[model samples]
Target chain A: MEALVALSIAVLTASGVWLLLRPRTFQVIIGLSLLSYAVNLFIFSMGRLRSNAAPLLEKGVQADPAALADPLPQALVLTAIVISFATTALFLVVLLAARGLSGTDHVDGGEGRQ
Target chain B: MSFLADHLIITPILLPLLAGAAMLLVNDRHYRLRAALGLVSTLALLVIAIMLVQLADVPAGDASLGRAYLLGNWPIPVAIVLVVDRLSALMLTLSAVLALCMQIYALARWHRAGLHFHSLVQFLLMGLNGAFLTGDLFNLFVFFEVLLAASYSLVLHGAGQQRVEAGLKYIAINLAASLLFLIGVSMIYGVTGTLNMADLAMRLPDIAAADRPLLEVGAAILAVAFLVKAAIWPLGLWLPNTYGAASAPVAAMFVIMSKVGIYAVLRVWMLVFGPHAGASAYFGGDWLLYAGLATVTVAAIAVLATQDSKQLAGHSLLVSSGTLLAAIGTGQAGVVGAALFYLISSSLGIGAFYLLIELTERNKTAGADILAVTWEAFGEADDVLPGEEEVGVAIPATMALLGISFILCALLIAGLPPVSGFIAKFALLTAAFNPEGLGATGEPISTTGWLLLAALLLSGLTALIALARAGMKIFWMPASTRVPRVRLIEMAPIGTLLILCMVLTVQAGPVLRYTQAAAEELFAPESYVESVFGAPRAGELPQEAEL
Candidate 1:
């Protein structure tokens, strides 16, 4: 399970970097979203990926660190996910506006064309 | 009054936030009301910030260490905390002053250029103030996003083709940086099992040898993310283009944004990896020094190359960041204090310069437009007639005021004498040269110290020449240029900032003493750790037991 998660993160990051290096704005946007997903998963895995374990503790019960999952990383990952979604939407709007203005999807606004 | 005093630290974040939301609900047509609310809120923030500064100055003892307000009254390390010390209070005051001045300037005309400008500015304030005050890493990330998001909207406020292109690049670059930040943060949390900065600091020393490498990797990645935001070389190439393309008031407010990155670097690096980090002490110090030097050199060249006033201001921002980074990399208490002073002066100077750019460019463009029309009406050959000899025209009062302000900004940026900039650079160089300033070990000054001094002096020279050249073109060489009709609202903000710089220069003694104390507090993080955790209550079984 650890190997699979690490492999998935590596693949997503590699693909994101490849796309981010592209000159097209749309590709960059997609790249950023992919990168953010990888990051979100990475943050989630910070808790060490416990299966069938609760993140919460019962009232008047002493917390067992070995049994329960760390809830902080989970909360952090959730916040990151929401933020990334909002930013992605904002990026898409910006990309569309850029496309309309420059009449091209190029990141440099077609400055290289001439 | 006690309740208000107890909760003073949170007001800087909450007031602007609630005001921004309320402003959003107001009808768009009633910009007047929105502007009034923003002004009043920012002014109140200024007062609160001042009070906070005073509160932080009063030493609350080794236990409390200057007021740590845990949100929801939860215990330390569990609830998010807002810690206000001398450093945070100083940052709050700086941001509040910048926001207030820029807010007033925006009301003049930029607010009308776009929808929700006032609200976005208010939101930006909330984000900036919160970032400065928050004690937890997660909250830092949240506040960073808040500021960046608001900045994205603010950058796109006065939409044009260039503005949109620049805004897109800015968004993309910042998003990538944010992703890296998350990865780095999670990696640190994974290794250390904590995200509260103080808690992380307390736990860093006890990290097992096997996990040390992982922690180093996380710190390195996190530093890269911060360096990118701070506009270090290579990663900062987008800054000039983006900041130059932003509208005047937005660009002015953004002066604080890069400083936010620097603040995080200083705070986190000093706390987590300072001399107290044992084997991990001064991690990534060498990289920061070299990258910072390169950033300074490149920014100086860019300053020399920039044709427009806005791009000049942007490159100046990079130069300021590089100087501070390099100074902090030196790890000298005195140098850090001097760098902090320089940071304040340069930020204010560049912000005022950004505001001045719009006024200067407006007249220049108006003059050029007239010239183009006249030349078109006649023939190109006739434009070169002997009767059309170009020479300096009579300057108006507004032009004179702008010229004075421009010179003051140039002097500050170039680190010329009789201003806070020169005093700051002097203090830094003095501290760098003095062996005693190299900490209690009295380590001899290395070649890096001399190299940094050279870079500092050379950058100042380059800035002087560049500003002289730009100033000649804009202020002196213009023949029969129309005087820009500067509004009092706009001019007053520029004057206010420049006067503040002057005040900093005049009151350099007390201010430097304050920054010195702040730097000492930063270097000795034990007080900070003790204050946050509150002496570790009996039967708590240690906070690290949760890990």
Candidate 2:
């Protein structure tokens, strides 16, 4: 289970990093978004891999308590996803403003892009 | 019924956050209302700060666990924890006061710059207060981004060619630094499996020594991000140019930006590394010492070469930061204590100094008044009269008063005796030379003595050179004759900051001593951990955080 989750993380992160190297502001923003998703998923999976098991501990169920996934990492991942979404939106607005004010969205042209 | 004890944890963070939200409700573009609101909120923060400072003077010096109501009683390291120790509380107070001053200063200077100034400044306060109080690594990052986003707008408040150009560079570098910060936190999380700082402090010491190289790398990278933010050494070149063009209040407010980095370095290093293996195994702090020394020497030279008012003040800040960093690198309990003391004084001193610089810059006195003064002071002052005094409002046309203020500002920053600048430096130098404490950078008493002596002497020389250049041109030399009038609103914040600085110096015995104690708290945070997360769970998380 760890191996499968690790493989998925590896693939997603690789793709995201590749996209991040793109030249345009739009592409860079997209890459950042993708990377954020990959990170959120990767962190969530770190609490020990669980397959087909519900995260919640059920009442009186004969379950391997040792196999239960850690809830902390799951919560952390949820928070990160929300924050990244806000950041991405803010970045988008900044990008649009930069393009409007300076006639370009590239990092080099305008001194105003945040 | 006991509001201070019960609500202390979240009050500093909540006040500015809620105020910023409520501010949006009042969209009156009138400067008077905006200015009043800004001042009232600032005064509220000042009250919060003083109350917290009083609490720190108690036996604890900082609260342990459960001082205030935790949100929903989830407890620390599980739900968000807001713990205010002596150091964090003091920083919140000082940063808030300076921020408030900047807002007042801005109201007078940029009457047409729009309502964003008040909102952004208030939000920035939220970020500053939050960073000081947060116990989680991710929360620190969250607060940092919040402040930086607001700063991006403030830095480019005018959107002029210079401001925009500077803002662009500032944003790009900071964004990259933010990314580095994220990556570092992620790496630590990947290793330790938790984000709670107190938890990480406990767990870090337990990590096997042989496989701990990754921890160093992660710690260093995180340190670098903060260092970049603080504008230390190679990473700080972008600061002077960015600051040179900002409006006075905006520039003055940046005094806190450097403190944020210094706080992070000191916080993480003292809390995570001192008790753990990082300090001893990595450079034995020799590199930190050298970096601090280099930053000081280089910055002094740069300040000497600078011509502009804001730019000169910028160099002085770098020098102060370098001094503080060097003291931290010494790693002695005494040195850290002194460094903490210096941090408080310098943070306020630089803020006040920056406002002074802005106040003067705005006052562009006409060449006529400058020449008249030059002639009056030095009996026609050599053969350098290249311009004539113009016939205008004789009492300085509003702008000349600002220039006069600049001379005072330069004197204050230069560390001449009687001003707070001198008092601030005296404390730092005394700390560096203390015979029994973090005493003498591991060298013989005499050898270390000379090094301290040299640093003190050089700082004095730097001040004198800067004064001669600024004074001769500004007060003694003929002005260019066509100066712009500086506003009264601009001078108010600068004056307030300077007066506060004077008060800090006079009461140095208590303030400096408190900072020293706070530094000790930072260096040995066993109590900090217990105060953050309950003693029971304190041992559970952060080892992976040092990853």
Candidate 3:
């Protein structure tokens, strides 16, 4: 399971980097989004490939104490995703505003014209 | 209600977060109201930090409260915990004080470039406070983003053409850095099975020997993200440009931002990597030291070449960061203390330069000189100053104050006597030559000793030759055009900040001792572990920083 997820993250991150090399700012934002998603999955998978049981323990239920997934990375990934989302939005708007003001999506927003 | 006191770790972060949300309701551009709200909020944060410090003094849990409060009492390694101790508390206080001063110093620009400056400023503080207080690495990243996003908008707040251009690169570089940051965090977690820093600290020691290389690789990658943010060495190519182009007050506030990275390096190296950090071949502490020294050298040369006052100050900040990182790499308490003290002095020093840039706009000589620094540093093809009339309408009081500020900052950066800069360098020099670390590490004493000495001598000479040369042109060269009247609103904050720096210089003794205490607190993981884990169980492993 960890291998499968890690492979997916590798693919996503690779594609994200390719997209980030694009000429325009908006595409870069998209690239950042893809990268963030890859990272979230990767961090979530850090619980060492646990399965066969949820983390929550139910009353009167008998289960392997060691089988439950480590819950800490989940919390970490969850917080990271939310924060990344907010920052992505913030960057997208800033990019749009810069484009509108300067009439360029190229970084250095005023590149070549100045 | 007393539980509120135990949960004090959250208050410093929560205070500004709550205030930022409330600031959207404030429609008017009244600087007084904004200043009052920010000041009150920051003062509260300062008080909370003091409380945390006092708590650190007390033995852990001989009382009713736990040092690290698990959110909702979910237990260690599961719930997010906010840990507070001497190091974090001191950093919180420093960031708060700097933010408060920057907010007040920004009043003139507030009305001039209004768009909820108060809200953004408060939110920036919230991020800074959160970054310092978070006991989890992922949460640290979260706060780092919060800090950057607010900073992004503020950089371009004045909406000038240069700001727009410079801010683009700033945003782009930071976005890339953040991607790198995410990758690093994921890699660390993937091997460690946890992201809580305290939990990771505990588990790291038990990782399989064969897997340790991956851990160090993950750590090195993470270290790069911080180095980027800290503007260390070649990674810092984006910094001077972005900072030089940013508005004065925003630039001043930004001086603290890189320090966050240095603090992170210290925190992670000590906690996560353990005391014998990078003892393995893969993660070399010596490399960090070499890189740090290189950064200092490059930045100093860059500053010498830079003619723009803002860029010069910006390069100086980069150099200051190098000093701190080098100290951390040195692994001596006294060196770290010097680095930490420099943090305070340089943060304030840069603020005065930013103000100088604003106040001296009308002085073509100074403005041209300021622009020169950027041109040289960026390797821009142009050396030609714009037409004489393009000089800003300079203010006289602003000019004198800024001139004094530049000299003082130069003196400080140079490690000249009677200034905090001298004290900062002194501490580092003492540490490098100290017999404890040199003998224990079995490292050559002469190399580190001579390096520190040469750096000290060169910095002094740089101040004498370059800064004095520039100061002569700006202050004594006589402005061809008179500056406008400096406003009381502007002068008040600048005076106050400068005055505070002077006080810090005078109180250098106590400050150095506090920094030592902070470093000791940083190094001793048992204090942190005990705070978070309650008591060590028999045969329980010592805590490790999350890989």
Candidate with maximal DockQ: 1
In model 3, what lDDT does residue B374 have? 42
> Could you tell me every candidate's TM-score relative to the true structure?
0.92, 0.83, 0.87
The runs of at least 3 residues in candidate 1 whose Cα sits more than 4 Å from the true structure, single-residue gaps closed, are A60-63, A111-114, B60-66, B366-396, B437-445, B535-547
Every model's DockQ, to 2 decimals? 0.71, 0.15, 0.43
CA deviation > 4 Å runs, candidate 2: A1-55, A59-65, A104-106, A110-114, B28-31, B61-69, B276-284, B363-408, B435-443, B446-460, B482-484, B533-547
Task: Write down the TM-score for model 3.
Answer: 0.87
Where does model 3 exceed 4 Å of error? A1-7, A48-59, A65-75, A110-114, B1-4, B29-32, B57-66, B276-283, B365-399, B437-444, B535-547
Q: Over the stretch B332-391, how does candidate 2's per-residue lDDT look in tens digits?
A: 666666666666656666676676654343334433453342223222211222222423
If the candidates were sorted by their TM-score against the true structure, best first, what order would they fall in?
1, 3, 2
Q: Better model by lDDT, 1 or 3?
A: 1
Quote model 2's TM-score for chain B: 0.85
Return the TM-score for candidate 1, rounded to 2 decimals.
Answer: 0.92
Q: CA shift at A79, candidate 2, in angstroms?
A: 3.1
Between candidates 1 and 2, the TM-score winner: 1
Prediction 2 TM-score vs. true? 0.83
Top-lDDT structure, candidate number: 1
